[model samples]
Target: MAAPVPPPTEPDASARICPGDQIGPCAACHRPTHKYGRGARSPLCEYCDAKAVERLGRKLRAD
Candidate 1:
């Protein structure tokens, strides 16, 4: 009988780090992202991050 095949492995987390730009995954969408401005520690991609901020602003204004 033939042996079963092993499952494919995911790349190491370190491998996903962009070497030249030091970019990594977005915190919200998990897409690759890079630092933009003063909020360097944020891992969110621009669109999701903007949406998050907008949602917060709406909540604050509603209160």
Candidate 2:
């Protein structure tokens, strides 16, 4: 009688953080960011996005 061979084992890959989309530069700050949908314009970085909101508030107050 012949014995069966065991399957090869591999290290766990789930622990690794992988981005499904490509990482590109942020439009406003040029920092590394995960790109969104295809054909979509680049988005602002975190700091720029927050600053935009603050600027909008200041503009409204000035009106």
lDDT of 2 by residue, 1-63 (tens): 834322212111221232545555667656555455555466654455556777785454323
- Runs in model 1 deviating more than 4 A are 1-21, 35-42, 58-63
Best by TM-score: 2
Q: Across residues 1-63, which tens digit of lDDT does each residue of candidate 1 receive?
A: 944422223322342564636565566665566654344564655555567777786454323
Candidate 1, after superposition: displacement of residue 14 in Å? 19
| Error in Å for residue 11 of model 1 | 18
What residue runs in model 2 are displaced by over 4 Å at the alpha carbon?
A: 1-20, 57-63
What's the lDDT for all of these models? 0.51, 0.48
What's the C-alpha lDDT at position 33 in model 1?
Answer: 64
In model 1, which range of ten residues has the least summed lDDT? Answer: 5-14
